[model samples]
Target: MPTSTSTSTSTSTSTALLRLRRQLLSTAYGNMDFRYQLLASLADRALAELDRHSSPEAEELADSHLRPEYIGITEGRALSEAGSLGIDTSGWEERRERIRSYTRGADAVTPDGTPADSAQRLWASLFDNYPSVAAALADLLTGLPPSWRMDLFQTNDLTQVPAEPRQQGDNGPETAPYSSTDWEDCAACMEANDLCRFHSGFLAGEQHLRGLLATLATDSIALEQLQDRNHEIGQRQARESAEKSPERETSQ
Candidate 1:
């Protein structure tokens, strides 16, 4: 069997993700951002698929995760597997039973378990609390170019997308020189122009570029917010530790 290497999405959301990954990876030292985008992309794909169609079995699988106790375990596993890779699913299969309960709506009102507040909740717990989530992100980002860390908050650059224009003429007013023979009475000068690679005008859309910029601004702001909160989490944890254990308290 031949090994395959390709990256493409079956849907527009996938396309957006592909572009996002490319944009972030275009910069230097971008591992965290790259991993985050990749994880988000994967989550988007799953959510899209779920919203479209699912087997009863799959529905059961989704429901199995809602128990307060199991919510922590299953959602954690889901995040680690996706953003972190499958590195932390040691107890994943077992957690699914609880998730199934949630999917079946068994825990809707009881509110005993740490059921997923939303899919975002799953990501937060896994990345912030689950040991594997950050590890997975770290691994996924390993050895990648710094440029891959693009977000709406930073620059979103473009790479060449291969393309060629089809022409109906050879030597006539519109034909590329390759088709000069097909043009019948077309001029040789026109044919030569068509054959010259330099003469080919590359195509891109101004509106598309504008849209990309807008998205970049949005992403950048979000990224900065994340960074701020992450910094705060460390401080918050330190403060809590000081309050909980007097021995650990700082002079401040």
Candidate 2:
């Protein structure tokens, strides 16, 4: 026989869990969008670099920048870039079409039987491809409130049992547990998480591009110096041969 108080507590927990699930879903989707924009900005910058100083090495770097293993992450940005560059994009189009068909099909779970939620899929795709980004997201998770973390674990079936309800006191309804200050702390943590993820992702992309550009610039400079040195040596050899030709004529 469950008391009304216990029943009410269970109901409250259920409601909180539902709210938290929605929040998680929303956050995951938002993060996916944020990552896509970051990648797209990087792709655009690479393309601009190619347009300004087109070289085989630069083009290859741009290709690598645009071509991530997870096609959905870029959403045809690579295909569009390939077409603009007059490269064959038929293979990419075909792959995208196949994915579209599969998404439209009746499969509700992944090959491993995990539920195929779009937000979760995109989140996993990004994190799996970008370890730094994964670290940033993990930091965000670490910043969550302990109670919220526990709720998340329970929601995901990671916990074997529900958390025990706080003991009621002589006072009424336990004063609602979470204070306004706690909520402000959660909000602050979320803000910090966003900033951390953005900065980390930006720095990663910038470093990759800068390193590629530097290497290409160095190679170009080295080639030019070699060509100049070879030209100077050829001229010296020609002048020496001309001087010896006059001496040979006089001897004859």
Number of the predicted model whose lDDT against the real structure is largest:
2
Q: How good is model 1 by TM-score?
A: 0.18
lDDT of 1 by residue, 1-252 (tens): 111112123233434333433443443234322334455556545644543453333234344543355545556556666656546556556666644432343223121222232222333324433557657866876857676635422454422322234344221122222232333222222222222222222112544767777776789886677679999999999998878786545433
**What does candidate 2's lDDT look like per residue over 1-252, in tens digits?**
334433443345434322333444455455533444555456445544543453344435434544456334464676677779999876776766654443333234232332334334434434434567768888997898867745756554544555345322111111111223342222212222222233444656977989877776789876677679999999999999999999999999
lDDT of 1 at 170: 23
* TM of each candidate vs. truth: 0.18, 0.19
Instruction: Quantify all predictions' global Cα lDDT against the true fold.
Output: 0.42, 0.47
Q: State model 2's lDDT.
A: 0.47
Stretches off by above 4 angstroms in model 2 are 1-34, 40-81, 104-252
Provide the lDDT at 16 for model 1.
36
Off by over 4 Å in 1: 1-41, 50-55, 74-252
The model with the greatest TM-score is 2
Backbone Cα, N, C clashes tallied per candidate:
32, 0
